[model samples]
Target: MFRVAVICLALSFSLLHAETDVEENDIDIEDESELRSKFEKFKVQYKKKYDQAEEEKRFQIFVENLKASKRMQEQDIGTAIYGITKFSDMSDEEFGAFYLNPVISNNNDPRPEEMLSADVAEQLTNVSLPSFVDWRKLGAVTRVKDQGLRCGSCWAFGSVANIESMWYIKTKKLRALSEQEILDCDFRSTGCHGGHPDNAFRAVIQLGGIMSEREYPYRGRNGHCAFKQSKAIAKIQTYRNIRPDEEEMKIWVAHSGPIVISMNATGLQGYRRGIIRPGAYACDNFRLNHVMLVVGYGTSRGYPYWIIKNSWGADWGEKGYFRIYRGEGACGINKLPITVVI
Candidate 1:
């Protein structure tokens, strides 16, 4: 009877070990499934190969980007922004060269001596301001998202876009102005080689305003200005440089219309979407680079931010716009805010 009992105990222990092995095997399968899913996402997002030996270098880079994105997601605490998992497939270097136009390729950014300057046209010192404002809600922004497309002509795009919005606000009619006109004609700016939107505004004025997109067309390259006084369909009464104060800039954006701005967009390279309060990085105020248009300002999850429109196509960001941490002079948010008074 004692021998029989010992044999039964040994059989029970063997069954327990078998259950433990099954559990461990299940965990291994789950981990592999998750990794496979990540690899699939990389393939679709970057349009790259997952198994090809010839593409091994790019595959390794994509994996590294994917891991960095995962780490960022895990480490960042309640950042009030959306996930960057969408950008997991593209390396930071690839993203920057494709979407960023902070500095032009062959030309230098305008020296302080060369940068165009506009005086403040109006100031709302004590006006009651709204808690939030979005020009898209006002139908001032266009639905057709513009694309800078590997060109340093973002300055021109921002300049033309804001002016177009101003024309809509003033005339209640939307007109697609030609950014190519500015890219080609604005000698002060170097087109794809980079330049200031401040100089871009000056170019529009010098050409007696700009022509419609249908007339001038965007070439995304620098060339001699083909000024056609006949095709000029939109004009700005005057352009102004908004005060560098955050409060005043809010007043201008809410009361006036959309405004153009140049800022240190270097930090925007890693951004995928969401209210981009740049983590672990601060923009150099002295080195303001890329130009963007501020369509509005508001709070997201109790964190105040500015809604900025980029020319890098809708596929790049939050339907062509992104939010940045507002106030505290984030990335020099209020620096060189340019808007037309039309």
Candidate 2:
């Protein structure tokens, strides 16, 4: 009786191992079915979200890809369909097929000469401010916009705008500072391609500072800057201007408040770079377009970076806000300016 019981136990253990082998063998085949089902379900769900015509068209394309994939080896089919399904969910801008095309070439090479050569002095020699150039010092607190023109003047617009905002913050008055004020009034900065915070700061100081937009409404399109007394609103009062060193920038930022500064961001235009990836802020390859107003800097992914505002209109990146690579001289390597009301 004991021998018979032991033999029965051994037989049961062998059966269990055999069952496990069968389960493992079935997994590969199961994977194919699971993948196919997943695609089918995804298609159905996607169809419901889109209009019938668009859905049908998309479905047809997906079907064609899936069928074509089947002719390849099973392994290839799994990989290809995985990619195909992902492509289906992407928005128009997210699509990378055009980027893959070799026909796309660099827009013009960076010409430092073209970027720096400005006719500000030639154009503005005759234009003069009113007897009283009322330049109001506005606030630095502003809603930064990502106006990804790829022209990269966003830094100039933002920094100058914040400088102008000091007028508002000081006297509870709103002033439209001149982007062209800095552009035309200062030979140091060439619009947006290349310039520094100090350039804008020095320009504001030399031009007897800036005036309100009521005195000078902005003509968005580029033209010869015409200064008129009829446009004269108020003049700005200059307080103590300090170009803070890197350590001083931090001190100023910590003690004072928001300040604008420039940074380098590659392909930051239109934000094709995926959802500000988890650890991407730590990346070192960002490019800088000289901007001003250093607000603050801190660590994000165990690495430090700047929290600078942009001027790319409200429609652009991260709602006109972006992260600058920290500690990389992205914002003048710690040599950024701090301005206050006089």
lDDT of 1 by residue, 1-342 (tens): 000000000000011111111111112223646545555544554454445664565545545654554444443333533232334445666655554534323433332422223222244444778888999888898753454345667777788889989999999888888888887888865677666666777888888978999888876656778879888998876766665677777877888888887676654544555675644544555455567889999886888888898775665456657787787676666756767777
Q: Give per-residue CA lDDT, model 2, range 19-52, as digits (tens).
A: 1111111223335565445546655532335676
Segments in model 2 whose C-alpha atoms lie over 4 Å from true places:
1-140, 145-152, 219-222, 229-247, 270-287, 296-305, 324-341
Task: Output candidate 1 Cα RMSD.
Answer: 17.2
C-alpha lDDT of candidate 2 relative to the true structure: 0.39
For this target, which candidate reaches the highest TM-score against the unseen true structure?
Answer: 1
Off by over 4 Å in 1: 1-36, 45-54, 70-90, 101-125, 280-287
List TM-scores for all candidates, in order. Answer: 0.76, 0.46
Error of 2 at 275 (Å): 11
- The pairs that clash in candidate 1 are 104-193
